[model samples]
Target: MDYRFSEQGGVTHVTLTGQLNFAANEDFQAIVERIAKIRGGKVVFDLATLTHIDSVGLGLLYIAHEELAAVGSSLSLLHPRDTVLRMLQLTEASETFDIIS
Candidate 1:
């Protein structure tokens, strides 16, 4: 997957596109690590353009959440595609994150 990072209203916004799968694991982790370094406020992942996600991608998301929380920040998943949304629901991920549309 490819992502664009920006800052607005003191919040970090990450817009992800393409497939978020194992192929992107290394890049995804690197990006998340960088994002985790931010001091505080919200980190929003805009998933509207994301087409697919696999188990590894989902795990990375959870890791990103925990890492950000540990730094006194937060992670929010936004505009997830219908299929991805279903995956999140099926996995009961809503309880672990704040998802916004």
Candidate 2:
């Protein structure tokens, strides 16, 4: 997986593309650390270009959510592709996140 970080209207946006799986763990952890510095801030994951995700990817999202919440920050998943969205929903992880279409 690959990601780009940008800022708009006081929100930090991370645009993800390619595939998200165990291979992305290291990179995703770096992202989490970066966002964790923003206390009480809003961070959005723009997943519109992300083509695929696996259980490991979902677990990473969950970990990110918890880390951000603990730091008083918010995390949102935006425009997830159909396949990725289904994975989230089927796993019942959607309810734990703020997802935006």
Candidate 3:
């Protein structure tokens, strides 16, 4: 997976592309670290280009959520593709995250 980070209106936006899996672990960790620095900040993950996600990818999202929550930050997921959305739903992660269309 590949990602780009940007800031808009005081919110951090991350655009994810390609596939999300174990291969993305290292890169995702960097994102988590960046998020750890923010206090009471808002983050949005744009998953429109993310075509696929596996269990490991789901776990990474959870880790990010936990990390951000611990630091008084919030995470939101935006425009997840159908397949990715299905996985999130199957795992009940849809309920855990704030997903925006």
Candidate 4:
């Protein structure tokens, strides 16, 4: 996966593209770690271009969420595709995560 990070309205936005699987491990973790290090910013994950995701990807997402929460920041995952969306829903994580189109 490829991600671009930007800032807007006091929120940090990350746009992720490509497949969110094991191949994306390193970069994904780097991005999440970078975001986690930043304090007091609302982190918005724009997953509109992500076509697929796996359990490892979800685990990274959970880590990101936990990191952000621990740092007193907030994280939001947005624009998930049907499969990824379903996975989140099936896991009941959609209730805790703010998913938007």
Candidate 5:
């Protein structure tokens, strides 16, 4: 998957495109670091351009969630595609994250 990072009004945003799978782990981790550095430590993952996600991708998202939570921060998923949204719901991952429509 491809991701772009930006910050606005104290919140960090990671805009994801393409498919989130095993190959995205390293890049995603780095993006998390950038997000963590933002003053409020609040992150939003924009998934509107994302097309698909596998188990590994879900794991990475969970990792990000736990990391931010541990630091007293938060992570939210934004505008996930139908397929990705279904996967999160099917795996019960949706409940673990804050999903924004």
Candidate 6:
């Protein structure tokens, strides 16, 4: 997936726009490094355009969550599509992360 990062009022939001799967690990790491360097307390994922977020993607998100939390930061998902929602429900992944409606 592709992501664009922006900051405002001390919040750094990374908006993802595309499918998040195995092909996107490099992109994920890049985003993570940028956010961590800035020490943003709130790491928001704007999934309004995310067509699908796969298991690998979920794993990456979990890693990101833990990393952020270690530094007193947090992660949140926003505007997930129906398919992604269903997967999260079935896998109980929603309960594990900060899934915002």
Model 1, residue 60: distance off in Å is 0.5
Q: What clash count goes with each model?
A: 0, 0, 0, 0, 0, 0
Model 3 segments more than 4 A misplaced: none
TM, every model: 0.96, 0.97, 0.96, 0.92, 0.91, 0.90
Supply the global lDDT for candidate 5: 0.87
What does candidate 2's lDDT look like per residue over 42-85, in tens digits? 99999999999999999999999999999999999999999999
RMSD of each: 0.8, 0.7, 0.7, 1.2, 1.3, 1.4
For residues 1-101, write the lDDT of model 1, one tens digit per residue: 89999999999999999998899899899888889889687899999999998898899899899889999999999999998998888899999999996
CA lDDT for candidate 6: 0.82
Q: Is candidate 4 or candidate 6 better by lDDT?
A: 4
Candidate with top lDDT is: 2
Worst 10 residues of 6 by lDDT: 32-41
Instruction: Say which prediction, candidate 3 or candidate 4, comes out ahead on lDDT.
Output: 3
Instruction: Arrange candidates by TM-score, descending.
Output: 2, 3, 1, 4, 5, 6
Task: Report the Cα lDDT for residue 5, model 5.
Answer: 82
TM-score of 2: 0.97
lDDT of each: 0.91, 0.94, 0.93, 0.87, 0.87, 0.82
In model 6, how large is the Cα lDDT of residue 37? 68
Candidate 3 TM-score, C-alpha based: 0.96
lDDT string, candidate 5, 1-101, tens digits: 88888878887888999988989888888977766665447889999999999999999999988878877789999999999999988998767999987
